[model samples]
Target chain A: MAELDLDSADGRREALRRMVTIRAFDQEAGNRFADGEIPGFVHLYIGEEAVGVGTCASLESDDYIASTHRGHGHCIAKGLDPKYMMAELYGKAEGYCNGKGGSMHIADVDAGMLGANGIVGAGPPLATGAALSIDYQDRDQVAVGFLGDGAVAQGQVHEAINLASTWDLPAIFVVENNHYGEGTPVEKQHNLDNLSDTAQAYDIPGVTVDGMDITAVAEAVAEARERARAGDGPTMVEAQTYRYRGHYEGDEEPYRDDEEVERWRDQDPIESFKDRLIERGELTQEEFDDLRAEIEASIDDAVEYAQETDAPEPSAAYEDMFVEQPPELERFANVARTDGGANGGDHR
Target chain B: MTAQAELEQETETMTVREAIRQGLREELERDEDVYLIGEDVGVFGGVLEVTGGLYEEFGEERVRDTPISEAGFMGAATGAAATGTRPVVELMFSDFMGVSMEQIMNQMAKMHYMFGGKAELPVTVRTTEGGGMGAASQHSGTVHTWIAHFPGLKAVAPGTAASAKGLTKAAIRSNDPVFVFENKMIYEQSGEVPTDEDYTVPIGEAAVEREGEDVTVVATQRLVGESLGVADSLEGDVSVEVIDPRSLYPLDTDTIVESVEKTGRLVVADESPLSYGTHAEIATRVQEEAFFSLDAPIQRVGTPDTHMPFSPPLEQEVLPGDDDVRAAIERIA
Candidate 1:
């Protein structure tokens, strides 16, 4: 309930708690997805927890962030309740999107977390646009766009960064280069060695940090936020991290060997951070265990709440398409309401 | 006042281009949150001159220009609209929508719905369409069908100067994302537009340009005027009725159905391609709503499934006009 102070020991403990919370939530989601409890595909953020938590730690609650398909960690880091996110994954009426947007599209706009985009490389433009809004209104705020390594190859990303730089808008482009974009390695996708080198093309400052180190990611974002607030335009930060799991729960990752995965796991962000905290006499092994247990229990409560929540009514599908339902959609809504959408099976 | 403004009030005769400019100027003055952003929209005063003199009035902050990046500006406008600002993005040409289709289809259209109706996108995308002036394939293609077919977005194509002014204002004020597809050929065409700043033609309503008893011709955009001309030439021979379905997506099916039920014969005309396009949607809705009242089969007048050619003769050869509407009416009536 206390305001976060990233500079203090207590704030570092809270950060560790958030990272653990993300890991537990995604772990449970992956297990349930494999067990057929969660429908649709889910892109887990198990290994990239520190990047999300640390990057968000550098931001104020009013600062905007646009996330990608791999967005659970970002949502959790942005302070969205886990119960509602779990309900969304379960396709329940109590979900963040009221069962409309499942895992990939979770959003809490009032919290300044733009909806997680389904389209790759789509977040940069939105974040840049948000920065444009900030500049237009003469507000002292920043907007950060969190994108994947694969998104760097997208044209819209280039346009977004160019526009942001040209206007000197207060926006930051944070690239989570997790070694691979889906099954393809990052090397195969981009000609450049360092993804942050992309900032050079737009005449903006760029930096690469150890994404596994929470402090490094936080420091880079903090500097970027500072420059942005000073009206120095955008900065690109590439967090070199890894995803421990496959791209999705059901992905059969034939691209990399087990040894490559083991090498990355050896530098696991959460475990390393916890070890450092204990060495500093700020935490003990028992305290860490208790923290993990507490987070696991909370995730369990989220799952139970999701299971008890009811599915949205069939007519709910046609409800959010517009602010006021026009006469044009009445015929389709009529059929969906009567047949429970069975007649329009092709639509799904 | 200038000659254009004098003409607007004296004879109430305002060109479509002038009417649209007036609407933008009024909205920009009414709401500080409303802005105009696009390529050449600031100092250049729009490539087609639709936004002329706006840059001088509103300045660069409001009438902002971009570096010819459609996807970036379109998505930025979408994001700006999601926030507190209302952005009216000029896409230059409808044919260029393919460059930014990802932002249009995935982000701009689906954000509000996917976000469980939490976000409101008061964004208006104004683009020009229609084949004329020898602008060739890229600049002259009519792509309103694509916007109309896509859900979570509204499409409006005005046929007259009055509807152009009214619909542009209405689209700017709507909470949902709206696309104003202006036919390039009709920009210079003049008509009597209401001088009242508050006068706005409601979206999703059909205007019976001229009513008759024997046959109904439902048309859109450039074809609306051509069909009206054909109806006039027919005089007493067929008693042809001409209707303009200004809004394409939430199409005025009731008005079309009523006209069809009374006339007993129908002809659907639009500038889009014949297959699975605007003509098909209008014809389908008419048959579904007024099937029993029809005495004759519905006829469709549209471009044969082909791209607009570069040659002026070839372009004219494929373009639908008053002759096509008259021929279709003759066959059905």
Candidate 2:
């Protein structure tokens, strides 16, 4: 039983829009990366869009979240501008982190979106600490750490959950169990059947939700948020979603069956949500097509903007190491200014 | 108290443990954001009782007791520091730092540099170091060299009661992440501590404990007191100058070089392993800065490259003793 406002026309439209936007954004990123226009490794979130959009639907604008490497959907769902994110993936200067943090390092701290960490199982502790700050300051906010199923086996993840639970910190841990911790299947890796069952060790509530349904995820997260705000401690919500694509863009995906991939595609989050909205009489076929086209045009503009933006100066690397750069950094920067860099030491 | 009266406040004899506890209490009272979190730091008053009365004075919120999970809470402290709060975490033994090295190196130390200076991580990690009580290799370690060798981490090890109080306060106030390596053996050693509420030993400064012109003895942690004792015993025989490099990472090389310049001889005694360790770094820097001023070769007194033995005789044989410092000075002087 989903408690989301699915009956409301505006709510349904917004959810449908978020899922569609993530699809448009990720597909464009995959294409650009394939065409060799984008630099660095790219992890696509095309298939598991519902887990991102739905969990975010229950959060306040000021509430914080930590994301994993495959984080474009989480960023998009958390209201990060696609133009800046896409530019970031393309390593353009106008990106969110000024091209300093490419795909895995993208962050918008002011938006309460703590960067997409390249290190797996790293986000849970950060989110737990953010919740500690919220609880210490007595703020009316909660934090969610979005991690992969693979992170379940990490010692830090267990510590994060135990700390949050013992202190009753305002944190919600949502494990996006996409059936594989990279190439290995969950069955081969874990002795337990359900990843959420690991939560019982911390003495907190745990649940498994249909990650393919946006409403189901939204309802579970909203309820967990309520429990956290009420000072009942943290809860673990395992979203049973699947990634139709490979782990990374060039993974070769020797891990799974083609039939299994096709099976997941049959339950594509975007197409299914779009049909639901049409069934609910919230939008006609023509209206739905118009919305899809608008999203495509917006994505096209992001690609154009990324291409137009200039690359960051090579010396931009030395600028952000510390608040006040130490003497060692200053000496190196001076050397780089007059030395063998591509910018010819003319940073000024 | 007025500035002159505050300066005139009586210096009291105290142990390093009490001095460190006073530092924690004053900082907790000074800022609401500062809290102490670690195992047995609350009702149990810490395993060694260095944080004994703090829990009673500050209550549960400020003086928190954590589970025996180093990586988890260390990572939590990093996150809290990046946000709005300042956290002071404790690792029971310096040897356990291996368990939490990932958080310490990657996140706590590198977050500011990686975020392009947009984030501030004002977190302090206080852990016990050294071996003298037969706590085996697993429990005893002087790992400050590894921490100091790492960039973005400021490290400190106070040799006396006053420096303990001062260094603890400085580590708490610093905007950067600092590691305070407290030697467990010196917890009971007594010295005069300044009674000022705001006194802080600035990081990267060295204290010339006993100034002499014949030989320079660079010491750290428990060896500082022992070196001073050695220098005293050699009073009329041979002149020995003892200098303590309180701050390890932002090392007080100028003070060290200046000492060697005057003495023309150098000897370093630290608790860590001798090879590729703190002593080596200091000795190499001394020679680089004052090679021409040297009268004899630089001498490093440290534990040989071996884990601390549990047996008393074996531990005594392996550990660098006060005699070691005297021998190094005698060889040069």
lDDT for every model? 0.89, 0.87
Instruction: Report the C-alpha lDDT of model 1 over A39-104, residue by residue, as the tens digit.
Output: 999999988998999999888888888999999999998899999999999999999999889999
Q: First chain TM-score in every candidate? A: 0.95, 0.94
Tens digits of per-residue lDDT for model 2, B1-333 = 111222345688899999999999899999999999998899999888999988889999988999899999998998888778889998999999999998888778877765555678889999999888999999987899999989888899999998899899999998899999999999999988888889988877788888888999999999999999999999998888888889897787778888899999999999899889999888877776677889999998999999999999989998987999999998989
Give the C-alpha miss distance for residue A314 in model 2, angstroms.
3.9
Q: Write the per-residue lDDT of candidate 1 for residues B1-333, one digit (tens) a residue.
A: 111332354337789999999999999998898999999999999999999999999899999999889999998988888777899999999999999999999998999888888988999999999897788888889999999999999999999888898899999999999999999999998888887877676778778888789999988888878887898899989898888888997888778888888998999899899998898888877776677778989999888988888898998999989899999999977
Model 1 ranges with Cα > 4 A deviation: A1-3, A336-348, B1-11
Report the C-alpha lDDT of model 2 over A1-348, residue by residue, as the tens digit: 222355578877887888889999889999999999999889889889999999988888888888899889989888899999988887776788878777887778778887788888988998998999999999988889889999888889999999999999999999999999889998887898889999899999999998988888988999899999999999999999998778999888888889998888888887888888778777888998899899999999999999888887887877766553444455446556755442122222
Evaluated on CA atoms against the true complex, candidate 1 attains a DockQ of: 0.51
Clashing pairs in 1: none
